[model samples]
Target: MTTNNIDILGLAEINVNKNMLRILEHMVQDKFKLYFTTEGKKGTGIRFLVKKEFAVYVQQFQHFEGRIGFIDFYTKKKKIRIIQAYINVQDKEKPQVKRLYKQIEHWTNQCLNSFVKDIIIMGDFNTKWNEYEFLDISHWRHDIFNYFKKHFIKESTLVFCDDISDMYTYIPNNPNHSHNKIDYIWCNIDLMLSAIDSKPRDVQPVIKTDHRMITLDLFMDDIVINKNNTQKCQPSSKTIYCYDEMQKTDGEWNWDKFNKDIIEYLDNPNIKLTTNKIRGINSHKQLNQLWNLFRKAIIHSAKCNIKQKKMKVKQNCHPLYDSDLKRDLNMLKGMLNKIHGTKLDFNDRSIENRQKIIAHITALYRRSDGNKSNTLSDFISITKRHNIIISNHFLHNKTFQYKDILQDTIIILESKYINATYEYKKNIMNTFIQERNQNYKTDKKKMIKSVLEQPHTSLSIDKVYKNDNNKDTFYTEENEVKEQTNLHFQMIVSAINCEKDLSQHPKWQDQYQSKHDVQHTIYSDLMK
Candidate 1:
């Protein structure tokens, strides 16, 4: 009943609310039937909201293709038909828009040819009337405008408007913005005249909403003449029944073909076999139970190992570990470990496992390279070699036997090896350090143990040396000087803590001392 020309960005920001519902309620009356169309990423979609009483009778709803939102609502009223439509705009310069208009025209004409007696088309037409004065007519695409005008006045009967005061439904609210009169309500001529004969009132404009409410008051007495005057509906009952039967049969046939193809593919020796063949037949509840059990087993195993390492580090039993360092290592392992049993299965494994591996690899690659330029395709190719190994083993199972299976397996393995050797080498090097604790040497191990035994303070010489091998005699001497300067800083900090009033503390003296010694020490030793 109400249609506004909504700016795309503004529309995105606004949340759907009770106010929107209130507007819709005023438009659709007693039947409580509402149909709405909106544009989304995939294109336009139409939804119907019928009151529960009428829902059982409402058969089908469809949106026309190639148009932004050309919706058709088909309903049977006392064995008669009615269709409500919302057509799209045609922009001349865009061939695609013009093509959509042609499609709507063809579709509308076909619908009019059918048995549908009552048709109501409403919405923003995105065209201007003579009274509208914002946009220049010379600059406007006249050809497209003319086509719509011709179709509107000639093909359909226009509903009379009582109030024509405000034609501009959409005001951009900017001084430089263009304005136009583009909204309308139209009905079939035959239906309009019959309703008009009963002395229907002019359409009234609803407040707040832009579009005016158009109503046709129908009398029961007038139906007697309309019944006798009804044209022979083009689609006979037999023809409609046959069309429906064919559609049902076609759907069944397509489903059967799809099932057969799936079965053949599962049984084939050439394609890599998977447990999906068995799992696909099981009920969803059963599959979920198995999936959950597998996930728990894998997660428990990974967590147990992580917890043991943390306990060892906390007890000062492992000299190689720091609490913070152990936490990070456990976190990384937890992230890489696959928790779901469903993820390890051969068929579902490809997509889920691939995503997990990609995420892991991408994070590592970014950390190493300082950018995301590393190709995921190279990593994916490497993983495919593992897939080939699984595939060869699956084909050699007793259930599958093809004469050329071994030959095909050999060819696949050779191709995988050629593509993935460099990638495999890189993956091995990166994962090798975590595979075993290779960084812990005897001296370094002792250093970590010494640091953990003492209470937390500024990092000691031994603690820093455990992590950094470049620190030799010169580095240690410089660090010792830095450590002594830090002790002097701690004494000054302790003196400041004793003063209740900040002003009582010698601010000038403290500032002068800090500047004289601290700055001099930092610049003379470190900078030089």
Candidate 2:
């Protein structure tokens, strides 16, 4: 499906069960709209996943699981139906094989019985027209091939092949056995005429499966037009699949409706809400049980009242697609070609396949190794290059002794942010400082060290200021000198309150000074 673009794709001989399909649906739920078969067992079951873009066009789909499936596309003109059939036989007359074709014939008629006329039947027929190297298949092929021919249908892939070897879809593991041309694409003459190749093409087994992925170039004549916007939808072009239809089902999940429905459902007496289902939520095990019940209740209410809204497409979508109902045989002349415009490739397997094969192997390699120097420089590789002749030739007759370059680079930036060559500026600054100091001498008398016990004001909390030698700030809150003075005052105040019993406590010691002693000491510092 990936070698070329495809709008709708169906798989045969897949063994995915319903449970497994649900898991796969969740993984790709955002991308594809999945459809399943009615067959109970998993073996050889058919599965269809329409791409989100064209899923809007899928009006209806039905399948018998492992046997046969058909999907109807709602085209602008009429409906176009595509059937996927997987019929396996042992090359012998059997009622089971006949019954399968009877079912297929019935399904084909069902597609034609309604408004659907342009029907495409494709899949693994699992049997060639001839057995022993295209010998004859009149006995069995007559019924099947001629039956489709009545409606102007023909095999799109194998019948047109000059040699089966050029396009063998399925190859058996046993090398000795002949490869088979069992897979095919059969379509209505109206749709076939619009095909780019008419005859389906085959891409080699880049895939791991034994069956070579067959392809067809279809719906090439049309273009997507919206007012002034035009999307050149080539298979190789990066196409933006519009999933608005699939994702916008019923518009969006309505919380109001959901809540109302849940409340009503819980109140309904007919629906039992017993202790078995209403498991307690006290412990981990009970909580898990309760969670399961809660989820089920939500799901039940959701099904009853919460279908959002279906997206609608205007009939006047494209004038190219418009046609009168009272047409002759040319009604479907270009309908199939127009379908190639969008969403039909929703089932393309390449979308998933592309994720696995990281597209730009070389680009990733270059990015990670971008910094590496593949060609090493000679001077740079050496341990020492202080004397490397940089710009030697350009400087002087192929000699790179550069004064301006070295002078700008090799400057002493010791304590200063910038380099300066003026030693006179430094001497002038020193003379000015000495002049200022001489002027300040004897200008004011300096206060001698005295009982300047504490700082007059407290520091603000906006920011803390500290000097390099402020050791007490490291241990506690105050400066070392201020802390000691504060402690001395605290002891004096305590001693004054209990002067008679000051000696009774060892903590007070005998250093409790009296008022006369304090007055004498305080005056001495003031006098100094």
Top-TM-score structure, candidate number: 2
What lDDT tens digits, residue by residue, belong to model 2 across residues 124-196?
8777645624565456634666678786576766444665554567778899987767777877654554566
**What local lDDT score does residue 92 receive in model 2, on the 0 to 100 scale?**
65
For residues 88-165, could you state the per-residue lDDT of candidate 1 as single tens digits?
344443565566556545655554433233344444445555433334555332443454445442222123443344
Instruction: Tell me the lDDT of model 2 at 524.
Output: 57
The positional error of residue 355 in candidate 2, measured at the CA in angstroms, is 62
Model 2 ranges with Cα > 4 A deviation: 1-3, 38-42, 91-93, 112-116, 130-134, 158-166, 198-207, 220-528
TM-score of 1: 0.28
**Each candidate's clash count:** 0, 12
How do all models score by TM-score?
0.28, 0.41
State how far residue 225 of model 1 sits from its true place (Å).
15
Could you tell me how far off, in angstroms, the CA of residue 462 lies in candidate 2 after the best superposition?
Answer: 82
lDDT of each: 0.40, 0.53
